[model samples]
Target: MTMQASEKTPRQKRGIAKTVAFVVILMTVFVAGFFYKILQPRVMNAVELRANGAIVFDNPRIIEAFELSDHRGEAFTLENFKGKWSLVFFGFTHCPDICPITLAKLAQVYPKLESDIAKQTQVIMVSVDPARDTQEKLAAYVPYFHQDFIGVSGDFLQTMQLTQNLNVAFRKVVQGDDYTVDHSGNIVVINPNGHYHAFIKPPFELARLLTVYQSMVQSF
Candidate 1:
C-alpha cells in the first residue's frame, strides 16, 4: 500500500503540471491577440478605396483632365476650380442608401472645412446615373444636402471617360422593375492643382475625418 501511494503521488503532480502549462499557453495567445487589436490604429471597415502612404497626399496618379458641364449647364474645365480646394464625390442622387449618407457626411464636414481653412472648398457630386440624373434633377437634389454642393453631369461617354480616369467603378442593377446602382463610395480630395489627392472611405467617423482632412489640405 505504501509503494502504491508514492507512485500515484508523482503521477498526480505530472497531470496537474500539464494542465497548468496548457492553460498558460492559452492565456498567452489570448493576451497577444487582444493587444494586437487594441494597439493597431485606424480600423478600416465597409469603406471605399483607402489610399496608403504617399498616395493620400504629396503624390498621386493624376488621371487625365476632362471637361464637363455643371447642373446649371455651365461649362467647366479642370482649370475652372483651380487655386481652391474641392471635394469630389461620385454617386447619383437616385442612390437610396450610401450616396445620401456619404453626401450628408460631406455636408456636415463642409462647414468645418470652410471655417478652418477659409479657402473655397467646392463639393462636386458627379452622377454615375446620368441617364436619370439630369441637370434639373441635379440642381434640385444636390442643394438639398448643402446649398454650395455642385452637381456635374455630361453625356454618358464623357462621364464614362472621366470615371474611368478617376478609377471609380459603377454598375447598374435592376430587380423587379426597380433599378439600382452599385458604385464605388470613395470621396476623393482634389488639391488646388486639380490632382487626385486622397480618398475617404465609408463608415467615416466625424472626428477622424476632420483630422485627416485638416492634415491633408494643409499639406498642399
Candidate 2:
C-alpha cells in the first residue's frame, strides 16, 4: 500500500482547531486572573472614596479676604493659604481638652501624608481667644505640637472674616477668675486654591482621617 495517507477531513481539522483555541483562551484567562489578584490589593486597598469626617465640596467656597499674624508675627492672609492645602482649626491655646489633643492627633497624621501631599499641606490653629493668644504665645504653643504647624490670630473682624465664612463659632466663658473659650471643634480644610473645601468634625480617628485626606488630595 502506497503509504495510506492520514489526512484529517474538514470535521477533524475543525475539531483540532477548536481544542487549540480552547486551551489558548483558558491560558489567557488564567494569566489575567493571576495578575489581577496580585495587583488588586495594592491598587484597591487605599481609600479611594470619601469616608469618615470628609465632606467634599462640589464647589469650593471662595475664601474671604483677611489679614492675620502667624506665630512668628508674620502676615498671614487668604493669599498666604493659596498654592497649598490647609487644615485649619479654631481654638484657644488654653483650651483644656480639645485644642492640644486635636493638634497632637493632627501631628500624628501629618507626617503620614505622601511627600508630594505633605509639601503642599499645612496645619493652622486660628486662636479664637486672640486676647490671650498673642503671636508670641502662639509661637510657643503651636510649634510645641509640630514644628511646622502655624498659629494665627487677628482682630475680631479679621478673624471673623475667616471663622464666620467657615462657620466656626466661639464664645468666652468665665469662671472663678479664669476664662475658657467655647468654640467649634470642627476643622476646616482649605484647598490649594485657598477655598473652603470641607469640614472635619471631631472626635477624630487618625486612620479614617488619613484615608479621607489622602483621597481628597489625590482626587484634586
Judging by lDDT against the true structure, name the best candidate. Answer: 2
Backbone clashes in model 1, listed as residue pairs: 47-202
Segments in model 2 whose C-alpha atoms lie over 4 Å from true places? 1-51
lDDT of 1 at 30: 100
Q: List the pairs of residues colliding in candidate 2.
A: none
Score each candidate by Cα lDDT: 0.76, 0.85
**Tens digit of lDDT per residue, candidate 1, span 1-220?**
3556456787788997899999999999999999988854433332212332213744665757677888888986778557777778898988888888888988888777636464567889998898899889999999999998889988788888888877789988987887888888887777777777777766766766765666666555
Off by over 4 Å in 1: 1-58, 114-116
Model 2, position 55, has a per-residue lDDT of 68
Provide the lowest-lDDT 10-residue window in model 2.
40-49
Query: For model 2, what is the error of residue 7's alpha carbon versus the real structure, in angstroms, after optimal superposition?
Result: 27
